[model samples]
Target: MRIIGRALAAMVLLVTAAVAGAVEEDGYELWMRYRPLDKAAQSALQPRATALVYSGTASPTAQAAISELQRGFGGMLGKVPAADTQLRNGAIVLATPASMPELAKGLEALGSEGYQLRSTVVQGKKLTVIAANSDKGLLYGAFALLRAVGTGAKLDALNTSSAPKLQLRLLNHWDNLDRTVERGYAGESIWDWWRLPDIRDRRYTDYARANASLGINGTVLNNVNSKPEILTAPWIAKAAAVADVLRPYGIKVYLSARWSTPLELKETKTADPLAPEVAEWWTRKADEIYRAIPDFGGFLVKANSEGQPGPQDYHRSHADGANMLARAVAPYKGIVMWRAFVYAHEKPVDRARQAYDEFKPLDGTFLPNVMVQVKNGAIDFQPREPFHPLFGAMPKTPLMMEFQITKEYLGFSTHMAYLGAMYEETLREDTQQKPGGFTVAQVLEDKDHGQRLTGMAGVANIGSERNWSGSHFDQANWYAYGRLAWDPQASARELAREWAAQTFTPDPRVTGPVVDMMMLSREAVVNYMTPIGLHHLMGTGHHHGPAPWVDSLGRPDWNPVYYHKADRQGVGFDRTATGSDALAQYAAPIARQYADPRTTPAKYLLWFHHLPWDYAMPSGRTLWAEMIAHYDQGVGEAKDLRARWEKLKPFIDARRHEDTANLLDVQVKEAQWWRDACIAYFQSVSGKALPQGVKAPARTLDYYKSLHFPYAPGRG
Candidate 1:
């Protein structure tokens, strides 16, 4: 009897081990993996997905949606749902008023690109239906349905619909012609430019599919630092070929135009916006591009920012440059996205106040088809920034929000910082405009005036890396950015949970801890690298690692010391009225609220006010002690993220699990490095001893300051 019991116990142990072992995968599929669910979920979903019934004309968009459904069902339920002409029990239907008039009642309210998914009964047979106003909507609906199934949502109770709030959802690829990506931590550029026009890579279709799944309908194929030759004939053919691959998936291709392209081409003497020859050259170029691409999206111009040439070179306003391009594309119904990130010519009193000072007065000057694209922050893309003042300041203009998906300021790709929290923070900021305050998200959706254009642009993190984004976890930022761009009001925490379920496994044991880790990761980075509103303290050129003592740069603003202003007295930038008065750029309510350091949120204390080291914090500790505690807490959190991932090993495939584990190892070291180096540098400046119970930095300030990484990835 004892021998028989031992044999049964061993059999149970073997079965348990098999259940925990997921198949090896390299994370190439991203959230679209659609791997088979657990037994209970598979059993519950299989019956509802017995057949696909769509009698509508299979347009390219429709065909794409149908193919995705088949792929998702085949992967998830172990069989591709058969296509049937007649509706049957357990069938999934794609419907429009033209295809199935009976099921199109609620679809009208869901605009052209919106969709509705519901479980309904037809002739006493229960089935699922994805109804939309157009084929594009059906495509988006199909992706939403797959997301539901992958996340293990109940099929019987499926009833949800979505419409993108913003009109233009785009990925801005800062990829150069030579294939090097600016601020791209992921491998080389995804566009195989050298071989593009003739030998199209299968990856292009996959890229379109990925973007379409998230409702991202546009992509700028080159770097914002535009080259003149891209407008030449040879490059137009390459762009047209890529655009063909993307068009069927409802995506349009946009190009970044060099302001001085005509001058460089020797077609015009001066690149001045008002000059007839310059205008004529652009018009002719636009006509040439449209002839090749036809459905091309308009240009994204980074004029007068950095060293990029613009109408500013001719002493003309930004409106003059943007309007010239707008007129060129207007005949083709294309819109111009004029970037509002202007600086670097002459040092301003406060760099944070530059864009608002320049743009606020010209709010009503831009043409209807032109959108002033503003970055999320007043400054560059810091880890945490107050929403750009232009959001509230320019009610007359249609402003588009630009978010950096690339981790330029946050630790580049390897660090486990989930940026959904950062995006959510900026989106949820109260602009505090007169009459009634509006959140930054609300500001983007505003249409009180006759304005029509509304959008959100994310700087692309995608590359030739097999995983798309450099690290496994970094892909979540790309996913979250797309989801948020669709609906700015969406919750970051919920988005993280959804991403966790689809990317890894739907099992609670895997998703719960993973989401927790993601939610904590961004804050962990902020705490270690730039806690309590400390901004832009990274090394000069590469923008990697810590270099708080870097003060040798030619321009004052180029140095980390210029921003932090750490001395023997205090650390932090002072934007108060007494200092730079950058805070005055906000609405009066916000300015009044942030005018006093004590009333300011601790998260943004140092951004607006500079205080003494011994100043009392709300935590009952001196400012010095609180800063030390935050650094210590961040190091512990980084370690905790690794430990959490370790526990999730059983639920994930071996390759992906190990990749994340290895990256987490790197994250812990980097987080520790950032903590130790910053604390060392700050302590030296403050002349303060280590606070009680806080560990001293492992190295001296000189040791950290002496270290340099000249060959860091992602440098321009």
Candidate 2:
């Protein structure tokens, strides 16, 4: 009996040791985790990935591609491939036409940044080839090869080609010099501003690798509310160090230029665009920057929005300010990204119309080097908004689409809301400006205009957190943003599937369910937070929780009450001719469609019209009851997200699975909090009883309204 007990204890100990040997991932690798594949997959890939042959010049970019392939093959197949000069069977050949003309045939059309992958025979040896026009394209091809294998593609049958539709794919970091990220829900800023240029973090290299994998070519290192000090020699040196690390990966560093830098630095008496001294100061500053970093991408200016100084303060047009800086950078072949998110201190009849009213007339006046960066929506980054009218309105001026990857208005980092659907919805929206089905994607690509400078910028959510993004799932948003930036017309659903397969196991059973969860995630947030076109109902200042009753803020548009305008009579702001005439900004077809409440899509019904509580919805329910139903439905979906994830636990490592499960718990509570508070406040105004099947608020209106978060994670 004693021997039997001892044997049982020994067996248990051996089992524990084996389980512990299987390391748990902390999500720091992101989607680039080239972990060992299953035995069958490894065996299948090993033959094709046995050797790497490069025929191009041994430049730094080519070396980077070689190193990445070795690292990926080593991890995925448990053996690094040998580098060989001679072509052989199962060799992965990388080349440009100048180096290996026969191997790179028909690859010239791919352009400098595009790549072609094929399985072909070269001199009687069947090999897989990665051919491009330049070293930058070779780097992209390397990542593509690894991505294909990591996502469970068969190597022997490889045949694909890819090119970025957009000219500039960038990540706009709102990181401050002090390391606080404005509207950033992650940890502190990843850029160690104080320690940079001398003591660079290895994480910077990883950041570049991740961005390069997604074809993102540029990064703005500071917040749009820029500091003049960034132009000083010390900060310029810091940016130069970051640029050195990213250059090999085909990325250029850009800065957010403070509009009044010359004036603030005391170099010029005024920052007026017309002033010769100010222009001279800008030219000298550009020269200094180019001296430090020769390939420096140019400036991203905020100018005249949210109290940031611009040419408007000097009684000049936006073009005047943009052209001044454009000329300064044009000498070095750099470009300027001038933002179009501007509004006045004094509120207009409709705040949404302010940007269009100011910039529409000045469309053709901007310099060729200047691209106007426009946010996806006319208003702030609401969960749901009509696509901005300026997409097609500015045909002569190049426009760059700006998307907020962080979830400031969509419940921050705690909630499990995937934003790919939101981005796709706006991209697919028809501007109806042309006769043959014009879309926002078409407007951005501008193929009709000869495919001139085009771009997409996502406000980065990266931070110093272990996972880079605040939460495990939040990393998907970053990945999706980059993929869509590379190709605006790419399907969000397909991107989500690719991300799921790479980030986790590539098994179809796991990826299918994960993609489904991501597909409906954004709509769930919309239902609970701001359903049916309602926008900006969050608490003032911090923007944390629900606060529909507070209307005492300084600016009328700053208050939540100003947006919903709820009363005993009805809810929603009227944007039609009957009210603010904001709808006139859209093309005539859309204006006509939204003129009547009956014709408008239900999702945007309240956004453009204020309907009575008793108005009949398509669902055969009153508007009041419909709103309540949406709130309840959203809460249920949040719970469903958790339940769906629970089933995935067996397939995922316990550490990441449990981390996501814990956040899902918080998300469920927050979703209920959003639902209950909104229903309670709107009910008070409507003076109506709860719908028959709906649950009443967990607490009173006073209890919900009394809550405050002065120390929220992203208060800046």
Candidate 3:
């Protein structure tokens, strides 16, 4: 019996070791895995590491910090550091100033959730100190140190203190309950709603780890075009289970609320915000949600837009609807994120002016718990767009910028488009409304009494794909979103380098070329797909491939022809004062710049003004010639990206390298397709001759127009 017991113990030990070994190999663990480094890097890291000592009682957050330290140390150094209850020589101490009076004196200058990591000696002992205002801050500090080490930075004199600029950094998943994600690529919805409360997938825990590492604090699990069924008792329980897993990582879960939920789910007669009975119904629903998940983040509502029912259905304004939900969740300290992407499909007026027209008047009327969520652009997430008019228009309302991390318009995951540039471009645009420094970042980082309660949300592109997002490079966009959300002021270029180092390797041979490729990627896509401000030119419904000629769809706004209005003599939409007067929506300085085609940036020329084919461009070429050159340039760049990546074959892994190589090949082919197809169709309408050195389309305009894509991958 003793020999049998010894054999069992040996078996258990072997199994544990095997499982840990396997986890180390899986790249799915992302940056948080903290696997041990190669010999050279490990040698650089070992001298700085000695013993782990934490100064606080074991709270969940503190335990999380300890667990991360253990995991990172074990993987990076091949051994976990021994934990000491007290600080000593060659020891690493994790503590808040309040927890250690001596350390508190040193940490007096640190900000909230900020930490100071310094090499110091106390009582003839050398130590590395991780001091913060709270244990959560310490955890963040530890992660930052690990990141620095991972990127092969020198560990000596590691004095660093950091805090998130934004309080709420969230990802909004546009996933439906039926597992059909709207504009979602990669795979079906990740939320396993049917089996959730009873069965928790380990993937949920991994998702939490990835998010926590990037300082993303919240996630909205469902689509903004929400279903009322998600608010039912059974679904609430399922959400609570997800919230439970996320809670440990300091992430709160939010739900998207359907405006007519009371009417559809509860059988209420009316869903009016002004109605007492409707208000009562919402309070009850809020209570039910809080009962199941005590720390539930509040609702995200997409009201009166895109055929979704809203308070406007009952003649109530958006503020009325948002305030009603805010009142219901105010007691629980929850917030209401009301989407401002509203426009009447039936309205023939400028789509760019609609959101501003609707919400700008209601400023300051919303409750403190309510935040008006505005998309980065006034129009849909186009390949390129001017800053939304609402950024500076609503001074009294807390505007939370919504950026689509998903590749809905930018060729899904097939074309390489780095959205970090897109995000940064929109945020850094000087609204030029306020007399002094008033960037979009300033509006979002607005504070009350030195306390920043601002928010930023990105529509997630993540799914159940092996690499998380569909393509390998798509992962960088996710990383970029989190970093930017934490600090809106962060440079996309700097973050690109950091992400490349962590994701691929610290080798400049690999990272330098990759960063160069990423920097120009978004512009390359824009040039090929919708260069010079041409928008909504993709095929109807699924939005895959080029179909600038698509004029027939269910609704007028649904057709590509409704947007670009190309004809016999010219192309491009006319949004100038003489046309839709959409230019009037922006500040006078910006409006004047956009209203005149001569002054408008050549990249956004077609967006703000209609132009004749004879229009002279800054490049000493006609609009027709320059437009053709851009398309040809885009195709050339795609080919160059493929060639550059192929050259890095020796540095990158065979599987990922080959995968990216294949995707780049597809990108080149499709870029040519967009060029040939768009030029062919435009020539058919405009009757223009091809410029010198330009090749004519292989297929006729009709052939390109007749092409059908009834079964595209992400059509659901």
Candidate 2's C-alpha runs over 4 A off are: 1-18
lDDT of 2 by residue, 68-130 (tens): 999999999899999988798889999888778787878756778999998887677779899
Query: For each candidate, what TM-score against the reference?
Result: 0.96, 0.98, 0.94
| Model 3 lDDT, full chain set | 0.85
RMSD score of candidate 1 (Å)? 3.8
* Residue clash pairs of candidate 3: 35-75, 36-75, 36-76
Give me the runs in candidate 3 sitting further than 4 Å from their true place: 1-27, 33-35, 104-112, 447-452
State model 1's lDDT. Answer: 0.90
Q: Alpha-carbon error at 275 in model 3, in Å?
A: 0.7
Runs in model 1 lying further than 4 Å from the true structure: 1-22
| Model 3, span 462-495: residue lDDT tens | 8877777888888889889998998998999988
All candidates' lDDT scores?
A: 0.90, 0.92, 0.85
Q: Which ten residues in a row have the lowest lDDT in candidate 1?
A: 18-27
Task: Assess candidate 2 and give its TM-score to the true structure.
Answer: 0.98
